[model samples]
Target: MKNVLFIAVFLCSSFLRAQEGTNMKRVIVPPEIVKLAFEKEYPGKTPVWSEEYVGDDNDEIRYEAKYDVNKTTKALAIYDNLGNLKAYEMQISLSQLPPKAQSYLKKNYPAKAIKEIAVVVDDKNKTTYEVGIEKDSRFYDVVFDKNGGFDVIIEKN
Candidate 1:
């Protein structure tokens, strides 16, 4: 099967990683568990792969599977190093968001234009919308509940 071949290749790559240790640079090919999870959840979708390292020293790495949900929406799911699903984000527009989310953004950030809108679905499938705004050379990801309640703001430099 194709999955089998994929897993074999992944294992080979991982063995190389284990031998070389963490100092290895360049993009990592994810283990089989990640591909299996992606297949089970999004059967018909083909994901374009990418990943990033988190933590102060970049000690932790997460894999991403990005795909399109529809003509207008682009979606991506994040997986932990062991291939557990963490969250999903869908790029959307204010008009595509739930009414409550749209209203909340309008009321709170009245003067600021939303640079990007994303619907974030956690592992439990709980959905939240994040509105992004760029101001003062910083990017802000403002989280809002489905009903448009304020959640939190994550500022990135």
Candidate 2:
């Protein structure tokens, strides 16, 4: 009787652990969204690679599609399975920033050095580019917003 009770308890514990492991909260992306993004990003070619619901169960549901135009290169796109474009980044050999932005930085901080730069595009189609510079043992964060048509510059003292 003692041995039987111990075995039953062990089985119950194992079953509970298994259930907990399987209960992962994950976002569900519809198939239509994936199809639309793929079509928009790649017009003539079919997707060479596709993945649905990547990442852990607790992570957001994202669909990734890749297409290859040549043997050594490929293009990649990531979209929410529900058709929302989260973010897409591509590497380029050259920088294609505006001349005005370059002149502004050069004129204002001639002695300063650029530390980092980042561009963020929100869901509402708004774009913000941030430029970080370091000068005289201080850090500056400059932000340029596309929709607002304004520049916000902050200096850490």
lDDT winner among the candidates?
1
Which pairs clash inside model 1? none
Compared to the true structure, candidate 1 yields what TM-score?
Answer: 0.69
Q: Residues 80-106, candidate 1, lDDT per residue (tens digit)?
A: 777888777777778877787777777
Alpha-carbon RMSD of each model: 11.1, 17.9
- Evaluated at residue 26, the lDDT of candidate 2 is 34
The lowest-lDDT stretch of 10 consecutive residues in candidate 2 is 8-17
For candidate 2, the per-residue lDDT at 78 reads: 54
- Give one digit per residue, the lDDT tens place, for model 2 in 14-133: 221222343232333348857776687667766533334334353555554444545643344456657766444222111333455666676777634775554444444445555656
Q: Pick the candidate with the highest TM-score.
A: 1
